[model samples]
Target: MTVDCAVIQRETPAPERPHRRTEGPVRTCVGCRKRELAVDLLRVVAVSNGNGHCALTVDQAGNLPGRGAWLHPDDRCLQAAFRRRAFGRALRITGSPDTSAVVEYVRAQTGAD
Candidate 1:
């Protein structure tokens, strides 16, 4: 029996699919530790609260200066971050940062009491 080596050699190769490009910067949510587009996550920065204490402030425009930690706008994510004490570690701050503003913003956005 003759082997059809020519037929196998003549077969066309399958086309390769193009890789999808991410449009913007990607960030990981401190709460869930899930990677997501920066636009989809909320940016927060640590600022002095006038009492020599650092507090977490939401940077809606994402233009705030200094180190920022990312989190999803969901309440669950906020709670998880709080439960894990991730903000302090992620923001590289000593002691716990006030989360009232972040919590309030998330609550308002999620309409959660």
Candidate 2:
């Protein structure tokens, strides 16, 4: 007499890995002190033309070389940053960097005067 046997098959589950952040780089807004993606905020850098003058220029293309400070394009944020002197602290500047250009740029981009 011959006995019949049955075999059972089982499937194994794969292990899960931690998800990586693929939404680009993250940076903090100097004005509001909020953490946001780098691409969403504007990049500004202190520029010196070697003429005993320095100014803060908005790096719309985000390709300027030097210490960069990030901020939102909102007037409120701008005011807050200015009030708190975040630009100087962030950029390690002794005197206040000319922010008119940056304000104008932000205004133009955000349509806020």
Candidate 3:
């Protein structure tokens, strides 16, 4: 019954908006191609030693710049990614993944097995 013009400004066409794009960061999962919020995916980095028992490690802070791989917090997804060499192929290098530690980390962080 009442239109508050002061509260609802008229939607008159304003000058063309500048070509500013609001982009959000994204990272792809090793097991899945779908891009996810950058922080949503776990970062996997190739360790320094090319040959070592644990040559792969997770980047909890996402600070390392060397090529990174992603894995969901889900256990099955992580298992599939590791089983399929998705991380290695994505990063093109690999030695070892402290899977137990990673699982523990994921569990503590995501609380999802």
Q: Which candidate is the best by lDDT?
A: 1
Name the lDDT of candidate 2. 0.87
List candidate 3 segments past 4 Å from native.
1-23, 50-54, 94-98, 110-113
Q: For candidate 2, what's the RMSD? A: 5.9
Model 1, 1-113: lDDT tens per residue? 88766644576788998964599999999999999899989999999888879988999988999999999999889999999999999899999888899988999999853
What does candidate 1 score on TM? 0.81
- Clash count, one per candidate: 0, 0, 0
For candidate 1, list the clashing residue pairs, or say none.
none
lDDT of each: 0.91, 0.87, 0.71
Instruction: Write model 3 residue lDDT over 1-112, tens digit each, in one string.
Output: 9976777568888898786333668777887666787677788777664445445667888898788888887777777786887866887764545566666766676663
Candidate 3's TM-score reads 0.62
Pick the winner on TM-score between candidates 1 and 2. 1
- Which residue pairs collide in model 3, if any? none
* Ranking 1 against 3 by lDDT, winner: 1
- lDDT of model 3 at residue 83? 81
| Tens-digit lDDT track of model 2 for 21-63 | 6599888899999988898898989998577667999998888
In candidate 3, how many Å is residue 46 off?
1.4
